[model samples]
Target chain A: MTSYSLILRTAARFLLPLLLMFSIFLLLRGHDLPGGGFIAGLVASCAFVVYLFAFDVAPVRRMLRLDPRSMVGVGLLLAALSGVPAVFFGEAFFTGLWLELELPRIGEIKLSTPLVFDIGVYLVVLGSVMAIVMALAEGEE
Target chain B: MSLMWSTEGAGLLEWVIIAAFALMCLSLGLATLRLLLGPTLADRVVALELMASITVGIIAVYTISSGVSDFLDVAVVLALTAFLAAVGFARYLEKRGHGDD
Candidate 1:
């Protein structure tokens, strides 16, 4: 693949972080909202895909020090572990669990096991999707 | 098509959705035509990309009309994979001597 114009590179540099942050936000709110881990991970991976298009795969690989396959493994582990917590609690597997915490200046924040599961899903999706992207971007370039 | 009229709120939102669906259909038809008739591999790839985007739009319209937000996740996934497929195919073409011209 050929390098894109300077304008695209510059724009992508500015856009990548925003896209990543948005994906995380999506993941955080996914249980109650339209967003989720799978979609968030896909969205985050697209940021890298755009970066790969404008620049190349080398920088992206360097940025992502961990291998994509490892990311998938870690994600699956997190998701599985999320379910295991319920098993230890003697609840049925994959049960929806929540925790309420009060923080200074921000009032109460609710956290849950499903969000952990979503994060795992997010990582899995990101890793798998980026694996495909890395294969394509690195091939014959 | 019938559901578009049958769903409640048959006012401006319904007409807007109908118009959006009509536009999506037209674009899908054009993309399919290009996919079939394009002389070059790049042209077909581009047509395929356009069709993917159109399909995403259709998914969004369906989500809106049905009042089910779950389908939006499907649309998001579609949009994400669509970009990946385009890049992969473009690379394949490059390896086949297209040279990314």
Candidate 2:
């Protein structure tokens, strides 16, 4: 009643790696591609889906060592704060702005604050699902 | 905004639509299957939560695809309301589940 069978636990264990990899792929391609942070987050939350299935919510929560909603709050704050750079540049809020640093060895790599915001969104979504599902799963136990 | 405006009407835009539609269908189909077949109340809750997140992803893609960030408004609404729905469903289930016992 408290934990999943061995087969399910194994499946859950393998699920996170696959999901995390896919989430990163989606996030990296977000700007020009259809994939993005929110989708990536949902994809990543598949790890939690497996965990909730593999173990009881309380045990999994203890292992996680973080409250999912609080994690979501941190994500939202980071995302919102990522917009601050726009204000510094006198651009509107949530402006898509970036910086390019050309290193002699590393080549021209472009980085954006928007990307950070997207990352925040990704975390927010994953955390949200984790929190909500944990509550429901707890009830089940 | 600049990205979308600059990339407007190219083959890439069409490709974006096709890929998004493909993923949307795939995820939604899976979610629907779980919704229909999920044996336990907790299973249904988890699946529905996934569906909500999927819906948000679709909306975000649509927001950029349609070249109107207005869809973000819809995304926000979905995010806010979806959580409320989860809470309500849990409470309702708690009551009904105990009643069954």
Among these predicted structures, which one has the highest TM-score?
A: 1
DockQ per model, Cα? 0.40, 0.06
Off by over 4 Å in 1: B1-20, B56-101
lDDT (Cα, tens digit) per residue for candidate 1, span B16-59:
98899998999899999999998888999999999999999999
Candidate 2 stretches with Cα past 4 Å from truth are A103-106, B1-101
Measured with C-alpha atoms, the lDDT of residue A95 in candidate 2 is 90
Ten-residue stretch with the least lDDT total in model 1 chain A: A1-10
Q: What Cα-based lDDT does every candidate model obtain? A: 0.83, 0.76
lDDT per residue as tens, model 2, A15-119: 657667867887877887667888888766765666666666766677667788888998999999998889889999889887899999989987898799989
lDDT of 1 by residue, A1-141 (tens): 464658768867976897898788888878777888987997899888878877888899888898999999999999998887788778999997889999999999998889889989998999998899789666655
Write candidate 2's Cα lDDT for B1-101 as tens digits: 45655664877776877799799879999998998898777777878899999999988887777777646755754664565566556545654654321
- Compared with the true structure, the alpha-carbon lDDT of candidate 2 equals 0.76
